[model samples]
Target: MTFRPVKATSEGQFTIEGAGVNLYRAFGFHKPREFDPFLLFDDFRNDDPKKFEKGFPWHPHRGIETITYVLDGEVEHGDSLGNKGVLGKGSVQWMTAGSGIMHQEMPRGNAAGQMHGFQLWANLPSSLKMTAPRYQDIQGSDIPEIIDDDGTKVKIVTGSFWGKRGPVDGIAADPLYLDVSVPPNTRKVLPVDTYANTFAYIFAGSASFRDASTPYGVRVEKEVNGEEVNIRDMSGNRTLVNFDTGNEIVVNSGPDGVRFLLISGQPIKEPVAWHGPIVMNTREELMQAFNELNNGTFIKDQRDH
Candidate 1:
């Protein structure tokens, strides 16, 4: 079995979004083609109400899908298509912004004002770029959690793994989004599709992605007993881990244990013209979307057809 090597390490930096809400942008708005099929990912986990209270206001999205997974708080969302709902703890909302749609997501923390969640953007193919918009809101209880004999738990969110299937289906990319937790010092090997592009985001604890060769253009550091062991010059919470082509991934956790999101999908290796929330195959199409939004006629209903 071939092992996917770590391509690079990126630390999520402080950024402001959604009406000045303080958050960390792990990846997006810069390198559009770095992760094919999957375009962007943001982790908005914060405890201070002042930092996230502003929340994401109304925005336009087209030719892509946005997946929002909440871990601790509630996210009230509404779209231009007259669809509105609330995503509580452990809930996930997969919205396909085909054609076009304007939406707003406001975060309301729990009683203690603690809010945490993630939003990932997946790119749609050219054929479905102008398809009708749709939504797949999956509750926390509906997601299947499989615990292995080795104490590794996987929350299947978008694809099948460990003999279970995820609720979000009919996706163009056929992605596998898994939330995995491995015991301390234990090793875990996850089986991924041989051809899919896979990557992991470390959020909870420290872990090492075992591979022989180091990835190009990525920063790597070693830790000894929770202390920085490599590159004493840099010490901070890292965000992203990109991987090379492979069918499996091996991970070894630190003393405090490890938790991360492993996401993989078939690459759509096509020309990408992205502008804000809209992504298209050509600049002309992107301009058309913007013009439609300016004209106040972006939403297109497919049910009528």
Candidate 2:
């Protein structure tokens, strides 16, 4: 019954990628070891179509898996392996870029000209880095959603929770991806694997997560006599919360409630040699991958065994 304490909190930085898609990079590229088994997380929610319509052009990826979850728009994607599909609102597409593959993702805003979604990169172990590429496209209808009496809602995108299993499986990381929403001023505690590297990305409202817990009650406390509360303890939209090892997480939502993505996975704990979209165990292997691309043999099936 130990509750995980928040180790750190950070806000996303605005970055433009692909041909010209504006996004907020929550975490990636700098400290790989801190977020073991997970490499990058990007939020590409925008109201202006011009900022995101160009989308991510054809790109090559290997030694990792990309999970794209769309909430308010549609994303049309195609790969070099001839796999193609559309990820509409509430849809998810998990692509394993084992060995190598080239893909393109083009986004279109919804009727209100609003596009919202997230992309997460999960690292593959060395043994499965060269495995065959695959795809698991899950529609919103297939995902399991649970509603509690207190108005708390949880959508299990992957992994098991509340005696229900997710539709997508066979992933190397075996991560739990949950979209959780808590009623305003409510306090909730959720279980997590003790050993897994867990984090939460707040995208809707503010909340507080701390090691201090009162056995009596968990409620949103207001400042008395106009005394301001510490801002460091509060996490708002686009804020990332990294937690220490524990079996559960406790959160107290603000006056407006909170919604966030809670994700956790077993750590691979291997050395990472990363360069752009290509990630390998060693620098030599990374160079070889680039060389293969230059030689027109980057795709595994096209390369000579």
Candidate 3:
């Protein structure tokens, strides 16, 4: 197995969205193909209720799927189809806006006034863009966790990791999503599908993705030209590590250990014309969606098409 190297890294920036809720945006809204089959990812983690309690109000979505995973909070969600639910700690909700749908998510903190969670947007292919909408809600207990001999822990959310499969399924991208934690100073090599594009986002701690050329236990700094630059220093919290193609990933946990979300999927090599919350294959289709939305016909049941 070959270890995928980090090609690019990003420290998620602080952004406010959805009725004034403060959150960190990892990536979204531009350069769509880089995370193909996936559109956006946002992390909402805060200890102050004043920062997150406002929550997202009603919104429209079409031609994509939104996956919300809660770590320590409760999210009350309602959709135009009359579906409603609350996602509590460790729970996940996958909403498919195939044809079209309007929904709202309101977040509330725990008794301690702390909330943490993530929302990931995955794109649908043009063929399934206008299909019927649906939802798949997975309880916290339904998800599986795998523990390794080396003290590495993995929580599988989608696809097969190790020998265990995640609770959520029937996804078009066939993504592999894992919440992983490595023991301090331990090196763990995890397998990923060779054909899938992969990346990891560190949330809790720091770690180094395999720079195979560098021997383990050496300082993470790299020599560039004649100067020593700290390359792996960028792999800190809220850092997104974009990897090249490989069947496996090697992570060397720092002294404090490391926890991250390892996500991968097949790329959708199609043109993406996105506008606000709607995503289509072309600009004309995008304009049409906005037109229908403005004309009060954005809902699938109300559209003539």
* Predicted structure with the largest lDDT when compared to the true one: 2
What local lDDT score does residue 127 receive in model 1, on the 0 to 100 scale?
97
Q: Worst lDDT window (10 residues) for model 1?
A: 229-238
Error of 3 at 77 (Å): 0.2
Tens-digit lDDT string for candidate 3 (115-170): 99999999999998887888898998999999899999999999998888998898
Provide the lowest-lDDT 10-residue window in model 2: 211-220
Q: TM-score of each candidate? A: 0.91, 0.94, 0.93
Q: Of the candidates numbered 1 and 2, which has the greater lDDT value?
A: 2
lDDT of each: 0.84, 0.91, 0.88
Off by over 4 Å in 2: 211-232, 302-305
Worst 10 residues of 3 by lDDT: 211-220
* Candidate 1 global TM-score: 0.91
Clashing pairs in 3: none
Q: Which has the better lDDT: candidate 1, or candidate 3?
A: 3
- Residues 67-172 of candidate 2 have per-residue lDDT tens digits of 9999999999999988889999999999999999999999999999999999999999999889889999999999999998899999999999988878889999
Clashing pairs in 1: none
Ranking by TM-score: 2, 3, 1
